[model samples]
Target: MLATAQALIGRKVDIVTSSKILAIRDASNDPNEG
Candidate 1:
C-alpha cells in the first residue's frame, strides 16, 4: 500500500508522508468531488 501510494504521488517515504496521507483522505472524503 505504501509503495502504491508513493508511486501514485511520486513522493518518498519520509516525515511528510503523514501529511500527504491526510491530504489523500481529505480528497477522498470530499462530497463535492468525484
Candidate 2:
C-alpha cells in the first residue's frame, strides 16, 4: 500500500522539485518534540 502511494507520487513530481518538497515536508513534521 505504502509502495503504491510512493510510486504514484514519484510519477507526479518532477525530479528536480521532489527533493525540495520532501525536505520541506520533513522539516514541518519534525519528530523531536521538546
Candidate 3:
C-alpha cells in the first residue's frame, strides 16, 4: 500500500515517526492505512 500511495502521489510520505500508520512497519497487514 505504501508503494501504491507513493505512486499515486508521485513522492514519498513525510509523516511523523510515531504516527500510527499502516505502513509504519513491514509486517503490516492492513491495506487501507498507507
Candidate 4:
C-alpha cells in the first residue's frame, strides 16, 4: 500500500520533502515554539 502510493507520487514526494524542509527551517526561526 505504502509502496504503491510512493510509486504513484514520486514527484509529489520530492515537492513534499522540500516543503517539509522549508517548514522546519521556518519553524526553527520562530521564537514562540520549539
lDDT of 3 at 25: 66
lDDT of 2 by residue, 1-34 (tens): 6656877777543233458878677668976721
lDDT of 1 by residue, 1-34 (tens): 7877887898755434458778788778976954
Query: TM-score of each candidate?
Result: 0.35, 0.34, 0.28, 0.37
Ranking by TM-score: 4, 1, 2, 3
Best by TM-score: 4
Which is the better candidate, 2 or 4, if ranked by lDDT?
Answer: 4
Candidate 1: which pairs clash? none
Ten residues in a row with the worst lDDT in model 4? Answer: 9-18
Superposed model 3: Cα runs more than 4 Å off: 12-34
lDDT digits (tens) for residues 1-34 of candidate 4: 6656887876333233457778888779976954
Q: Find the 10 residues in a row with the least total lDDT in model 2.
A: 9-18
The C-alpha local distance difference test score for the whole of candidate 3 amounts to 0.61
Model 1 ranges with Cα > 4 A deviation: 1-18, 31-34
Better of 1 and 3 by TM-score: 1
Say which prediction, candidate 1 or candidate 2, comes out ahead on lDDT. 1
lDDT of each structure?
0.69, 0.60, 0.61, 0.65
